[model samples]
Target: MKSLIVVDCQYDFIDGTLACENAENAVNSIIKYINSNDIKVHYSKDWHSIHNGSFKDNGGVWPVHCVQGERGARLHEDFYKHVEKDVKRPKEDNVFYKGIDDEVEEYSAYNAENSQKLSLKDALEDEVIVAGIASEYCVRETVLELLEAGHMVEILKDGLGYVDSEDHLKNLQDLMERGVRII
Candidate 1:
């Protein structure tokens, strides 16, 4: 079945802990797209612990955000409304929780340290449309991972944004050369 891979649309990536200006509108658009389509929606979340390396104590690239069971870790209330209550996730819509281990950093949903990784290659039976936050960082990394895993990746440019537009575009161009379709 066709899959919609939503990377880190959590509150932290929007306007919570580590909100990026570029990711705000894109996340809203991505949610709309998923709600409008029949394709299965999959999301990668950074559910970190207080002891995570990304914290102030441990040296890392970013500050701590999505801690498991915390308010920051919860999906945006607007997006969560779209998810069916009766439908248990991972069954109808797979959710890959990243950074659960707190030590190893996982950018791609297909790979995680604590939780089971979602096989982007094996799980996708049809077209895979990707959308979400921080185009220069997590978004870029996940897209490349999907491409490397041999799955066709269609990036929703309109539904996504970046911190560094120039750098993000360069990465996008490089991926395009490698066969990732941008839409």
Candidate 2:
């Protein structure tokens, strides 16, 4: 069975404080892929608390974004709309939240847990396809974790957003070398 993991396609990563370049286009492509494919879908969000260390206010490099219960923490509107119309739409339990703990800085959705506390690794199929925002960070880290866990992984290249074009390309090359298939 194949599953698709949509990683951190939140407002913050799309057009909010930490927005990435071409995020809107990436999201549109992801939505199109979702509409065209028959794969099971899962989503990850950066639901950070105010005290989370990943926030610049809390001494991290990133600006305040994806704060829990904030507008930026929500999924992109278009993606959410597509989900609402999907026959095999993911339930709330299929959406995982990361970076909730103040001291923990989680870039990978691998360890993220859903509302029911199921880890991403535990919930995903052995064969997985991934797509989402900030290709150099969350997407990259999630793919690495999937590989390390012995899963077969593919990256939907057109469905990715990145903070920097050059860094994104470099990371994609590195991931390909490490055995991730770019689709």
Candidate 3:
């Protein structure tokens, strides 16, 4: 069965730290698609520590966001309200937490540079339809990893959005050429 992996579709990415206009606009449509499909859903979250690179105390581009137990760390308020109770766990739907360590800057749902593998990879165990924010960064990284692991991949065009449209488009094209489907 197809699994829908929502990669960092959090408030931090949609309307928080890395919020892009396109990403915010894509949220509802993505949610609708997930609800309508009735397929299993997975979400990856950037549960960063206080000293994460994206914080003011560190050298990073983004402002602090998605810190554990913070408002910015929470899911998009509207999306959360819409899909809260519906989210399954330990299998059908689970939140893969990343960026837990202070030094590692995790850009994908899979794993940080030195962390253990994401449970999402094994749980899905099949092709995954992925959608979420910052296409140029996390989305690109995750897609490549998924491909390398031998899974059929598809990106929901209207569901995933980008900060750098041009660069992200170029990367998407590269991924397409490498067999990641865009629909």
Clashes of each: 0, 0, 0
lDDT of 1 by residue, 71-183 (tens): 87776665666544323233323666777777787777666422444454455645678888777777778877777777777888877766677887887888789787888
How much is 48 displaced in model 3, in angstroms? 0.6
User: 1 or 3: which has the higher TM-score?
Assistant: 3
Worst 10 residues of 3 by lDDT: 84-93
Clashing pairs in 1: none
lDDT of 2 by residue, 151-173 (tens): 99999999999999999999999
Q: How are the candidates ranked when ordered by lDDT, highest leading?
A: 2, 3, 1
| Model 3 alpha-carbon drift over 4 Å, by segment | 54-56, 84-93, 112-118
Top-TM-score structure, candidate number: 2
Best-to-worst order by TM-score is 2, 3, 1
For model 1, the local distance difference test gives 0.71
Give the winner by lDDT: 2
Q: Relative to the unseen true structure, what is the C-alpha lDDT of residue 53 in candidate 3, on a scale of 0 to 100? A: 77
Task: Note the residue pairs that clash in candidate 3.
Answer: none
Model-by-model lDDT, in order? 0.71, 0.88, 0.75
Once fitted onto the true fold, the runs of candidate 2 whose alpha carbons sit more than 4 angstroms away are 83-90
